[model samples]
Target: MKKIILPLMVVLFTACKEKNEKREVSFPEEKTVETPKDTLTKALEEEPALLSLDDVADTTFVRLRDYNRDFVYDMKYATDDNFLKTKVYDCAECYVRAKTAKALIAANEELMGQGYRIKFFDCYRPHDVQKKMWKIVPNPQYVADPAKGSIHNKGGAVDITLVDTDGNELEMGTGFDFFGKEAHHDYTGHPDEVLKNRKLLKETMEKHGFWSIRTEWWHYNLTSASNGKVANFRWDCE
Candidate 1:
């Protein structure tokens, strides 16, 4: 009877141990991490929102880049690559009257849809810069008389060309600021591709309220900005 009882006790102990080892256990789930709302607010406050063109007055001068980032810039006067052969501007900035900016942005959007973009060589020349250009090339045909003030001085004009997605400027018969009959809108000496490229630029700009000059294939003036006062404020380079 003692031996049987001892065997039974050992069997019971082994069974209890097996059951304890096989018992199911659970642990608390980890919480998901999220950024704090105050941290997000601080981040937003660091970067100011871009202003809309509609919120600005039409005649007010504004940097084109501030309103739209789509247009490409190769401001010639800012460097010595222009007809002046001198860096007339402290920095390369494209500023136009708000009305001009609105039209240019619209025109660029149309060009972009056709897989091309507008590349600016000049925009909104200050009165002093115009005088400097006149001193270099006093030809009224090329450089407008500073006393008379050209559309550019009025923040109404832009010198531009079309560039493909690869940034290769389309063959517009002549380079920007080229003063020759070949650059004329009526000049038919160019190849068909060049004519087509010019037509695309001219028509698109006209459709968006800009008119092209008879001589400079690259120059366009916003119709509404024709009466704006000539501006002379220099942009801060820093």
Candidate 2:
């Protein structure tokens, strides 16, 4: 009986020891993950749409200043500073066909890359203003015939010169609306720098789809814009 009781007690003590030594397995604690933010999408959501030629019609007239701010404006005919010595325009505003404006913006960008920008003397003359200019000059060589209509009346031409980044006009050997052989592209009597400047302006303009006439150094016509209609619609000054 003693041997049996001792064996039973030993078994019970062994089972109790095994139960006390046993431990449940534990895993690592979980951590919260954070997602990265998309900055480009956030910025695009906050920004407005940019102006583009795609938003405008090719033949539609657009205010040049509204589209580009790099150009400098003199608008000679808008004041008494031109050869006509008359302010024909109601105000000094530059407007051009959408196609012409696109070409000019491209040309001006190229010029700006070369440390120069286009300074406008005249742009998109009204048909009535063209008639007024013809009455003042009365010469086809000096002014375009209003009956036939100039490219300016058609919103395809710009009278421009090179200006530095500081807005100082480059010496092109002739002022805007200067009616003489000196303004002629073939005339080689000017200084080397003047010739170089004129060549830069001409070549750059021609490269951007403009053609210069033999009579005017400041004038350029957009080849693509030649087919546009003559416009007499005036811009309000207020």
Candidates' C-alpha lDDT: 0.89, 0.89
- Please list all clashing residue pairs in model 1, or write none if there are none: none
Give one digit per residue, the lDDT tens place, for model 2 in 159-211: 99999987899999988878889999999999999999999999999999999
> Lowest lDDT 10-mer window, candidate 2?
41-50
lDDT for model 1: 0.89
TM-score of 1: 0.79
Error of 1 at 132 (Å): 1.3
The top-ranked prediction according to TM-score is 1
lDDT of 1 by residue, 1-238 (tens): 9989999999999999999999989889889998667854575566456679988988889999777777788999889998778999989999999999999999999999999999999999999988988998898877789988999999999999999998889998888878889999999999999999999999999999999889989999998888878889788885
